[model samples]
Target: MAGESEYTYVVDFDGTITANDLSLELAAYYGGTGYREIENKYRRREIPIKEWLRQMVALLPPDLDQLNRKALEWVSIRAGFNDFLDQVREQKSTVVVASDGFGFYIEPILKAYGLLEKIEFVYRNETVTDSDGQLKVINPHAHKICPVCGNCKAAHVVRIKETGKSVIYTGDGSNDRFGASWSDQICARDRLAEVCDEYELSYSPWEDFYDIIKIEKPDLKDCSDISLCLPQGQGIKDGI
Candidate 1:
């Protein structure tokens, strides 16, 4: 079995870590009621995800600052996430947050929790305010062929695997399908779990980061001697 340091975790933000999906929340709150209709079309496969993302962005107001503030105020991470990061740090493992959502809010949310430096890298869409004060998305990591997720999580996972470290992916969204396929191990829940089921990919179902730590570091499950894991009975809320 591979030890903790032998793995590189490529994780998803939004629904995976946060108690809710920030992008969808932003769209529903700021993008208007029609946002759900557009999302439904994408979910139903009536329209491509690229177009769905574009339409969602179009619904947001021009104030990037306001959006960032709203995200900071509303964003809540999974319980025991801090403990998981501590373990990753102790093992010196690489953990990357790869998401299709814009980074404008992600950066701030991570910073707020003092977990910004704990992440090895972040791959996501860049957001900027144009001269006309409108929100614009800059996708540097998008694959021209894939056209679904603005940022290609699978590409990053493949690159990490080339470094000789096993990749472990954790996610809870449809956008994670390709990346989950590329990972050596998958820690899935909610929507991503359903996707894994359809493809018959073996995965470890998780309710939160605690479940992940248990599977990834079983020896540390009862490591109360170390402050690496949360105290038992201190349960965390999971929206899913």
Candidate 2:
């Protein structure tokens, strides 16, 4: 086995590890046509992910068990994830999953696949039934003042880096940009790749975790100057 290293992989849960986005699948499955309206707003950048979750959750049914069951039935782990975990374990590197999605189903899905224990931590939002008996989204991981992402993935990356671990942020959504910008290296795909290109951030395009395992660790650099948000500060760029 390779000896332990200073690398920590901060991965996205929805589209990165899974072949499909479970949150989107759940919302579309239960939210009916309303899912498109909210999704379009997020894609157009009119609303941040935090607002997206709030609006999307309202469209979902309040039954958590039913929702989780559907999620378990629909989720498919992407190819190479198991081998990637084995490689990470051999190298003694850390893995953390961060997501801005519905959040309630993450653990259940991971546990179902027996992958939950391999992860060092998971940062995500929660969907709960409010006192009024409505399903609502709660973000304990969000920035106190920043209403951008429900889960501040950038903050998670910054925290890991503070522990002297170099982070490799891997994701496939536009909302992942903030966190990816703070990471030492970025493994981007789909919308996240486009965002990285638009912002002039260097990233490696990947199709699956197998490609991720082959990526070389980059030299640590100060990414704050090019990063989108300041995790230690207000969490968003000016005018955003």
Could you say which candidate leads in TM-score? 2
Q: Which stretch of 10 consecutive residues in model 1 shows the poorest summed lDDT? A: 228-237
lDDT of 1 by residue, 93-194 (tens): 878999887667887899899998999888888888788777778777876555456787767776676676788889998668767777777898988888
Model 1 steric clash pairs: none
Give the runs in model 1 whose Cα sits over 4 Å from its true position. Answer: 217-240
Cα-lDDT of candidate 2: 0.90
Candidate 2, residues 34-115: lDDT per residue as tens digits? 9999999989999999898889888888899999998889888999998898899888888999999988889988888899
- Deviating ranges (above 4 Å) for candidate 2: 1-3
Cα-based lDDT at residue 202, candidate 1 = 72
